[model samples]
Target: MSAELAVVYAALILQDDQIEITSDKLQTLVKAAGIEVEPVWFSLYAKALAGQDLKALLLNVGAPGAGGAAAATGASGAAASTEAAVEEAVEEKEESDDDMGFGLFD
Candidate 1:
């Protein structure tokens, strides 16, 4: 896998195990896995995730129809709205492509 994907997988594992995901933790995981990635990527990942709810973000990611139902409920719903919006946006793009009389590959 790519370094970024490896880092994300490490973070997911840490989260699943109830460990805080941090640059140091990511570094240790990556090193233990025998992957050599640039230190800058770790810093970037840390910065990007700072002050964000990683669990919620992970839960909502790539889950299409369920996001709308989740968001319609309450505070836990807010994060899911992002996912729903993404799904709608993807649908819109696909519809627009159909209207254009050409496949994306064309």
Candidate 2:
């Protein structure tokens, strides 16, 4: 695996075990797994995640908040209207085509 991916896996393992993410811990895990990772990657992830609740972050991934739900609802409404308009246009086209007195068997 790539160095960056190895580092990510190591961080996930540390988080999964409820261990604080630190450069040293990340390095230890990566080494134990026989995966090579850059020194900077471990520190980068550790510092970035410092003082954060990893579990909450993991659980809430891709979960939209109130405003996000509102936006999604608005988008759904717009998509429904657009779909209805397209269907109406298609129905009109089909009706007009049928009135043209044209048939394959003719």
lDDT of 2 by residue, 32-87 (tens): 98987779988998998898877778777765565455467787785786689899
Candidate-wise lDDT, in order: 0.82, 0.82
Candidate 1 lDDT by residue in tens digits, 18-87: 7877899989999999998999888888778766678988777876566666556766566677679889
The whole-model C-alpha lDDT of candidate 2 against the native structure comes to: 0.82
Error of 2 at 74 (Å): 16
Displacement of residue 44 (Cα, Å) in model 1 is: 0.8
Q: Evaluate residue 82 in candidate 2 and report its C-alpha lDDT on the 0 to 100 scale.
A: 69
Model 2 vs. true fold: TM: 0.56
lDDT at position 51, candidate 1: 69
For candidate 1, the 10 contiguous residues with the lowest summed lDDT are 63-72
Clash counts per candidate, in order, are 0, 0
lDDT of 2 at 66: 50
